[model samples]
Target chain A: MTSRSALLVLADGRFPAGGHAHSGGAEAAVRAGRVKDAAGLESFCRGRLHTTGLTSAALAAAAAYGLDPAALDAAADARTPSPALRAVARRLGRQLMRAARATWPSPRLDALAAMYPRGAHQPVVLGTTALAAGLDAEDAAYCVAYETVGGPATAVVRLLGLDPYQATAVLARLVPEMDQVAERAAAAARQGIDALPAASAPLLDLTAEQHAAWPVRLFAS
Target chain B: MDRVSLRATARIVADADGGLPLLVSDGPLALRRTRAAGPYTRVTVVGAMSAPLGGDRLAVETEVRDGARLLVDSAAATLALPGRSAEPAAYDVRITVGEEGVLRWLPEQLVSVQGSDLRMRTVVELAPTARLVLREEQILGRHGEPPGTLVTRLTVRRAGRPLLDQELAFGPGASGGWDGGAVLGGHRATGQLLVVEPGFAEKPVEPRLLGENGAVSPLAGPAALVSVVAPDALAVRRLLDAALAELAPF
Candidate 1:
């Protein structure tokens, strides 16, 4: 079980995982008119959590439980099609690794740091990083779920110019769904990646590509 | 879609008089085939953003048997045409590669045209020793403009438990499916996803990151699952290279 304090920290938006730097595609979604105010943002977040979140949570569990981090990492890499976004994962990964190591401090973290010297995606690194930090499989799964949606929700506040309260309301409403997603992910984590696979939507795929070439950068991607 | 069994609508007949099927026959999503052994059917698959309707949906599901292999291409760079009714275009695709079956599901970028509403579900189940290669491309916005609003959902499940389930609600803020750095980097314009199973040229499976374009995660196994989401084919190609390199390894 993950301590409530640890869960709070893991769930915190200011934990320095470099999550703030990413709009979770919110900027691009806004640019595309796919996401507007908090309501629209919620829908986008829900879609992502349902599809992409489900996959990432499973992979994070794979990393937490000691599955081949490399294999799960590879799968996560494959699932993310946007080159710009992928670059963001590696960069955020490097940043999070730096942060996790400093906050937790451990040899296993050292091993992962050595594995991907440049950086690992937040999911892959988070799975193991949470384990190293003493978060359980369930907690790790929750972390992945929260991070997946929260990043964009935060971005929604900035991109849509909605009231922070509105953003918080939307996120709060998604809690039940997030719990369901985490539960499903936790279940898959027990089975391993072979027993589990991921599927993602295609428009998001193209959006990443389009966002990648944007001359001006709002988010890392 | 438990309400629907992928097998109920099986075997796409190519011709009469003991001929192959227009679409491949699939059993529980895996590969299957029955050949009178003649010239097989060929179909081109291009990009599509919204769910296909009428003949277009049929085009999306058209298949050729083992005795059949399609050189898939696109029709005017597929677009996600908006729907007139509330129902999104539903695509149910089943492919069976018996002994030596080959079906290529490839297409150009799928552009989600403005005011397009779509829903596509592909239930593919491959046998233990089956071989397959499928490519799915989807793009948002028409001519660089985000298509007004729509709901495009994609779900692919194998052997029961769930492989991929995606729902893209583009209308008001009512849909909740995909978001996060894990997928589109929180942007919206265009995105494409590609996945392939085992059976490619032999290589030392060492999955490595190729260009600074993105990161690569190397899979260690006989099966390879690759996905590249990009705004255009070029970016998808870059992602494909990194993914292939990672999946095939050195």
Candidate 2:
């Protein structure tokens, strides 16, 4: 049997909030000759968990562990140099805050919402929401880790190139890294987002650039 | 009483003799090329059609056969003529990507000038194990022009699960005027993009430089979709078409 709390966390599509609309750049990668199929997807997801997912996980843990909302926001923003990434972080954060506040009420969450006008990022908002929900710091880390990779998998399946099983398998393979990233992300949260290290992936960025020019497209930036 | 409609349909046959792209590996980059500017190759419409000058609602559809690649490009910047609320203009694009087939459906940008009510929708369906690369961009108001209220809805799905869907409604400063941070962010230009990587959803690839006035996010999965609403529709369209060609033969 699953805990009602945890069930709501995963079962609700809104929990991921506008995640359905994003490809995590899967479309871009497949289009660019990088990711081909299940094998390629697995390789890509693992890499993300190690790099971007790792960074995002840390930020999420920090948010859960009670990091300064302003500091976390700036840190996540600065670390994600790509304007597209930055926009995504904020867009997810802003919308998440709106929904979290409505569903799970908390004063701390309110304080975080106030911070958005000042440019708060999604991970930080997510962290505050986790804290309000009484979730442990680890939960935040895991959620971020899972989300960073999970999003693209869903998008790919929706795009009709991979089976649901193949995408889930990719997630399952990342479990080990998910554990490792949880630890590292939690530990890094102590040092703050600025001190955190990041390995930027270039292929994703190129695909995003290419996708931005279509006359008739399916996603919103 | 005057009414207008423009429809474009194209079919691509792979191995149509060796051609550009120099890549012939199960790639059928069949395309319908329409001249939009000076000294460019042009394809005539098979039948029923009318000149598209913005404001006029335009509809487009493209299909790729299994093991084929379809590439579609346009001639010039699509301008939306200003119209009253009761007589707004619209444009529609429908597409299908078959199994092991590739479709790079990239066209020019849509420029929405002042007093123009433009409605556009794009629907895409992908087969099981199919692949596609697409691009799209929109300019709210062109050349520092004031952008009044705008409406647009876009949808993409595979096996009937929504991958990306967007709905935007705004008027010249919907967020309490242009200076409001709630809207525009004072950037004057906006864009949405999709990069479809079928297998790798959360894969983090490096962001690419698309040129000035453009930005790229990290790679997400096997398929990525983006919406880029920018300042000058012309500049964005020019950038997108060139990029899609390089992403070919399929």
Candidate 3:
């Protein structure tokens, strides 16, 4: 049986994967007055959960399912419209590769690192790392789906100085939808790469590009 | 279901003296080719319908031969209306550019009226040395009308390798996420311009906010994709014109 603790270890916010520097676009939303309180935060999380969250989860699941890593990486590149986000993904992936190699050594993981010395997409690396850790595709999907909201949630707390409990409550309220998105993502993995979801948030993409050009910003992107 | 299909191709041939470039095309798709001051052949649409109805299917195929340059444009905007059918209208476009060839496609705006649904897919294949400048514009609805459905997908490949693939879905009940402040931010008109060239350098261009609501950003690739969302079609056109002036080579 796969170790249940592996999921926890991977999902922990303090895994030291360099995800802390990114706000997942929450910083931009908060600055624009789109997300002020817990209520608006929940709405923002829900929107991201269905679009970018779902897309990332499916990519992780596909990687965990033992699909070709290079193909999955290409798909991830295609799905990401903003160059800024793409750079962030690769940076995170490189960081995750270091942690994963030390935590759970595997030939596949080593091969992936060698192939993409610059680093593959983060979700792809996360999925492959989950595979190396004796976990399944669904487990990897759950980790990614949760992080999709968790990253932004933490960012909002820092950016707007909102109540931590209220932000936690926003994530708690999204548990049901998150589970649904994770399940759909894992199922889509079995259907092949072409069948994967391409749902996109154009505003998020535009804002990401805009945010990258900013001379001053708290988060990387 | 009423369906419309168009197939068109453009090639460069030797002139009577075998000196200047002569543009030739075939197929039912309308073509009004004119020689510009430059080496590019300007092809404008003629005898085509102004709008598409429900269940309408359109297919346009174009090719630019080696050492040839072509530009495509339409006389007016393409307005999609709800037809008598139960499903949405469809448009499929395929384009191929040969070695050292250039193609510039700047179609007019596609406005979706109330109760209208339109699905469009464009696939482009290019040689390693080919150059392309393509633009797409969309208006959700007529002023004061409810928004309709529009799903657009673009895939570009060079030497059999994918360079860019993007899909956008907008309309009612499609995905509220797209309408969120972080996404489209409640804008009605949107435009995209893609420029792909060999040995191109990344330009440090910031996303500029046009008028009250429009903004443009340059994406990554040998291609630079500029997207803008505005309050209206005229505003979007102005934003696109400015962006194209900065990004487009020809």
Candidate 4:
């Protein structure tokens, strides 16, 4: 059986994967006036959960399912159209590779680090890390799906000085939908890498590129 | 249910005078070769009848051989209207650019009317040295009504490698949150411009924000992609037109 604690460790906000530096486009949305208060954050998070969130979860699950990492990496590149977002994924992947290798000491993670050097996509690395941690595809999916929204929620509180309770409550209300999204992602991974979701969030993509050009910003992406 | 099936093909090869050597069109898609100032060959797609309603299958294929430059555009915007049949309409566009060849595909907008469902896919194959400038504009709904259902997938490959492949869905029946804060954000008009140039291999374009609603960034390959979302078709075109002029690297 997989270690349940490993799953929590992977999903914890304090995983030290360099995720805190990025707001997953939340910083840009706030500047655009698209997300202001707790309610606005919930709407923004919901939109992200279904589009890029679902797509990232599926990739993580496929990686955990033992799909070819190189192929999954290419697929991740295809699914992400914005160059700014692509850079962010690779940066996070590199960081996660370091932590996962030290914690789990797996040959698979070592080989992946050698192959990418810089890093593979974060979702792909997350999946391999899940494997090293003795977790399953569903666990990996849950970790990624939650992070997809969790990163932004945590950042929004700091960016707007919103109530921490309100932010936690927003995530609480989305538990049911997040669970469904995670389940769907894991099931799709069983089909194959080609079966992964390619949903696009145009506004997020646009805002990310816009955010990358910002001279002053709170988050990396 | 009976559905209309139309398959159109256009072929072009370099001629002695840099003209079109072979051009073909069939079905409701009539290809009209128009004269332009440049040495490149230009063609316009003139719709012979109202088409692409529900249960309809339409395909357009174009090939630009080596040493040839071709430009293609449509006469007017294509409307996706509800039909008697419940099945969704399908439109497939395939384009191939040979070595050192160039292609410019600037089709008109595709409007998704209420109660209609349409699925469109565009696939492009380019040789290592080939160049391409393609634009896609989509309007979710008319003036006051809500959009129906529209789904589009674009797969572009350069030298047998994926450059950009994405799928977008809008209106009813799409996954939840498409119109929410992070997705469209209640915008009804959206589009993208993709320009692949060999020049970018030496020096990639810097990421830049276009006006307020759009942005341009370099892809992994020797190309650039500009994405835009606006409140109306006019605004979308304005941003995309400006982007195309600034970013199109021949």
Candidate 5:
């Protein structure tokens, strides 16, 4: 049996990955006045958790299920509409690959790094890393689903100066939905890549594109 | 379960004297060539029934052979009406372009009336040297009526490799709504234009936010995908045309 701690190690906020630079669209949302305080942050996170968050969880789960890495990468590229978001995904993937290789020391991980020297998509790398760590698809899904909201919650605390306690409470309230999303994602991963969810948030896509053009910004994307 | 299946192919055949290109098509879908002042052949949708009702299935398949240049246009906008059966309406479009082939498809807007449920899928396969310029616009509902449900999926591939894949769902509450959480963000009309070709370059274009909201971004294959959202169809069209002008010669 795979130790559950493996998931903790991968999902840790300070996993030495490049996630800190990204606000997960929180920067954009904050600039547009969509996320002013803790309540608005919850609404934003909920919208994201159901849409892009669910999509990422399913992709990670499928990767952990041992699907073809190249195909999953292509699907990831297809599902993401914004070029700016894609660039961030690849950059983070490259960073995660470096950390995963040192921590897990798996041949598959090495091969994937060599295949995509520039970088693979982040969720693809995360899922494969979970596989390398001997975790199941649901574990991988939970890790990504949590990070999807966690990263943004931390960013909101910095961007809006919201109370850290309030932000933590927001995440606490979302735990049940996050678990449901992860469960559905793992279930879909078993079916096939075609069955994966294509839920998209157009406002996020548009705002991300707009954010990329900004001259100065706190977060990368 | 009856469907209005339509299939058509456009190929350039060498003339007896090998001088001018001849365009030929065979299917229920009509093809009327226009004397447009351009290097490409302009074909208008003349005879085919364009509107689709609930539970109605419609398909249009087109192929452009090597060295052929075809431009397709619709005479009027397509209105998706409420289904007669329990299931929603469905439309599928498949297009293929051969080597050195160029295709430009500019169809009119698709309006989804209230209580209507429509699913539309479009797939485009292109050869290595082929180029495609496609445009699609959708309106939520008629004047002063709540919008219906619309699910659209578009996939583009070159040489068996995926270039662009996008799926959008719009309408009531969770899938979409006028609230800030909705995909449309309270916009009633939305449009997208895709330009794909070899050695495509990204150009700098100013954002169009005066009358409508829009953005243009480069895709993985060096192509460009432009999206525009407006309060009405006219605004969306104006914004789309402005964006397309910046990335023209597709």
Candidate 6:
């Protein structure tokens, strides 16, 4: 039986997926003075959710809906223009695969891991994990959409030492928008890969590249 | 505004006469073969009249045959103005580079004026040994005015494999938060430089930042992309020019 609680577990911050090391460009944004407080963080997350967040959620939903993983990997690469971001996705994918395999054993995950031993895109692996957990495409999309902002929110707490409750409140306010974005993503996935959203965050792409070159940065990207 | 469907074609092929490139032009896009001091054929795009108004379907196709080296540029910036009909203007550019061919597509900036809407698509296909240096810049609006809606997509394929495919949107009707702190950050001018050299396959480029607003990163293939968001066109050009000099020198 498909359990809805699996979505909660997958979306949880303590999923052991190596996501704690990354800030999804929040580190760069914070250092650049674009994000200095809760309001700034909210604005930044909202921007990311609609652009890269929507694109990623759709990719994950498509993979969960049984689209070809290889093709989706190529599409993800095309959508991600920054080489640094690409490396981060692959690394996070490898880490997520390791954790998901142990949590929910499946031959599909094994096949994907074998096909891309180094790693695939994180969203593709995430969708495969959702499939293994007997979850639907919307579930996968929800997980990605939430994580898209959650990663930054948590990182900003540590980076800026802002109030944790305030950070959580920022995420709480985005809950409705995240649901709308997830629904849009699931619908977009049904339309096929070509119809997927190509929304881009150029500043995120630029800042992520700069973050990767930083030797003293706390986040991986 | 007059709504018209126009298609223009340009072709370049290297001949036995000292490897000089052949040139062709058609319709509103007048192609003039100009003399250059370097070992390359230079073609200038002189606009026959104001074009790319809304509700217009326009296309410019250019091909570089094997063993040819071509450089293409425009005389002035292309302005997208509003049309009477609500239909958005479409501008399509198709470029092909054959084996051992080199193409430098350095057109002037494209400015989206107030109340105009445009959708532009640029597709490039390159052989395995071909080299390309392409630059694209977009100005959101005229001075002190908010921009109209504009969307652009660039797709490049090398040797039957996808190298890069990206789409950017701005102004009204685009997805929300495009001008927010995480996307354009209210920057009016944005541009990128793409350099595809087969030699990079052996020694890939190292990712780095260009000043405060630009970044250069290597693609999955033998190419490098430099993206910048700045306050104006001149600032955008400065970073792109620096990146071009570092990535692809004459």
In order, the candidates keep a fraction of the true contacts of 0.20, 0.05, 0.37, 0.73, 0.31, 0.65
Best by lDDT: 6
Model 5 agreement with the true structure over B133-153: per-residue lDDT tens digits: 899998989987887888888
Q: Please name the candidate that would achieve the greatest DockQ relative to the true structure.
A: 4
Query: Which residue pairs in candidate 4 collide?
Result: none
Local distance difference test, per candidate?
0.58, 0.57, 0.78, 0.87, 0.78, 0.88
lDDT of 2 at B81: 54
What are the per-residue Cα lDDT tens digits for candidate 6 across A58-86? 99999999999998998898788898889
Question: Could you list the iRMS of every candidate?
Answer: 7.6, 16.2, 2.8, 1.3, 3.4, 1.3
Comparing 1 and 2 on DockQ, the stronger one: 1
Candidate 2 vs 3: which has more lDDT: 3
Clashes of 4: 0
Write down the worst ten-residue block by lDDT for model 3 chain B: B11-20
**Top-down DockQ ranking:** 4, 6, 3, 5, 1, 2
Of candidates 2 and 1, the better by lDDT: 1
lDDT (0-100) at residue A72 of candidate 6?
A: 90
- Candidate 4 predicts chain B with a TM-score of 0.92
Tens digits of per-residue lDDT for model 4 on A1-221? Answer: 78889998888888888998999889998888888999889888988998889999999999999999998898888778788899999999999999899888899999999999999999999999999999999999999889988999999999999899999999998898899999999999999976787877999888888888889988999
lDDT of 1 by residue, B167-241 (tens): 444433223454433335434433323343445335423333334233332223233344444445567666765
Tens-digit lDDT track for model 4 on B101-158?
8888998999999998999989999999999999999999888889989999888889
Q: Residue A199 lDDT in model 5?
A: 69
Candidate 6 wrongly placed segments (more than 4 Å): B1-28
DockQ for model 5 equals 0.38
Clashes of each: 70, 65, 1, 0, 1, 0
Q: CA lDDT of B43 in candidate 4?
A: 86
Report the candidate with higher TM-score, 2 versus 4: 4
Cα error, residue B168 of model 5, in Å, equals: 0.7
